[model samples]
Target: MPVRTADAALAGVRRGVGAERLTGRTALVTGSSRGMGRAAAIRLAQEGALVAVHYNRDEAAAREVVTSVEKDGGRAFAVRGELGVDGDVDGLFAVLEEDLRERTGSTDLHILVNNAGVMGGVGADEVTPEQFDRIFAVNAKAPFFLIQRALRNMPDGGRIINISSGLTRFANPDEIAYAMSKGALEQLALHFAKALGPRRITINSVAPGITRNGNPVFDIPEVVEQMAGLSAFGRVGEPEDVADVVAFLATDEARWITGSFVDATGGTLLG
Candidate 1:
């Protein structure tokens, strides 16, 4: 009966103060200015996480996300850093630490979601070395270093969730670099899970297929219909769809699962 914003979805958590699932935890979500990252950050906030919404260029959008979370009766702050650039990971942490110490009185972190990335649609024959380098820098290298740096501040039972893609399993030559980066992310999770298992920290990847990530195709009726037909549900996946999966992975209920590539593709890989 009403149009629901991301903040509206989080109102359920406001039924009672301190009734949320992650009341004392802190989460940092990269590229949270829009799309799946935005939804994931908001949902985590709904569960009572003090979310650090990170963005590169769109400071306005990042502030919007923080506002949305705050409006939902949750806590969030915006952090900025250009990913894929040198010192990006450390730069992000520096700003975040200052904010945390000022606001929460501590720089400790519990959850790290690597969601900022670049998508390349260049085919092998046409892709240049520069494009390949940029894609890997943003999609793979950034996450790797981010996790490496986060482990220091992260305590036991922390969660590291990397946003991957179902493209790794499907053959899409136009996006080969993007797919390869996701594969590398899965492998990173596989190894990191073991490395952090002693601390009870879990690392995993959530791979989604063809979700509305600022893609104009979803706006065109004919194109949307064709893409929806690809899924068993006969509908396109939304940002919230993958956000829910990422949120689950960050929760204690998903403690048993680690080093796994979860298919959040809406059964896109089923058939």
Candidate 2:
């Protein structure tokens, strides 16, 4: 079988012609220039949400996402900010708010997806203090503060979704640092769900396992088949597989669901 791209995974979903469940709402998805973030941004836009595509440095790729959204009659623009750095969250919202206000006459964000993360591929012994710090800073600290800042303008009935990892539940020695970072991320949803409940703003964490993310390894059939076996369905998880779940959480129908860690891992390691 041939390798499948993210777009191919979304082929079945009707774009520019759907329920428009998120009409008039505004969403910001970080690290959306590629992979699952890109898929979520598109999926939300398909449901009629004006999306802000955030990227660290890939302006060209970000533009491509914006273009793709606009081509389908959806509204989208790109914003850039490197996570894990001082003033990263502040700088990101500065641009995001300005663009939002200019377009909709309001700075209220309806959905926030904390998806940008770094995977420090090092075992426990080989991982350095600096490596651990950076990983936590990006995967944990940044999302924590991003939510803090987003609350300033996020209206009641808003949605906040953080992209976690299956490594938190399963074990991967080489990804110990990365998994720990995601574990910290999961804690955010657990506590915030209660805190934000009164305001009707839902917060949840989504954990995906062994997803195909445009990595060259996925291009090789042998590697693909081996990884496919990890899933109960005998297939690798697609970006859309995870994005569809994020999109559902952002809808009004999910108002009662909060502070949950959704397993988007395709039942990985369920044997």
lDDT of residue 145 for candidate 2? 99
Instruction: Give per-residue CA lDDT, model 1, range 65-118, as digits (tens).
Output: 999889878999999999998989899999998988887899989999999989
Against the true structure, whose lDDT is highest?
2
lDDT: worst 10-residue window of model 1: 1-10
* Alpha-carbon deviation at 6 in model 1, angstroms: 14
TM-score of each model, paired residue for residue: 0.93, 0.95
**Candidate 2 lDDT (Cα, 0 to 1):** 0.92
Question: RMSD per prediction, one decimal?
Answer: 3.6, 2.1
lDDT of each: 0.87, 0.92
Per-residue lDDT of candidate 2, residues 1-271 (tens digit): 4433334646676643578999999999999999999999998998999999999988999999999999988899999999999999999999999999999999999999999999987879999999999999999999999999999999999999999999999998999999999999999999999999999999999999989898899888888888877777778888888988999999999999999999999889998
Candidate 1, superposed: residue stretches over 4 Å from native? 1-19
Best by TM-score: 2
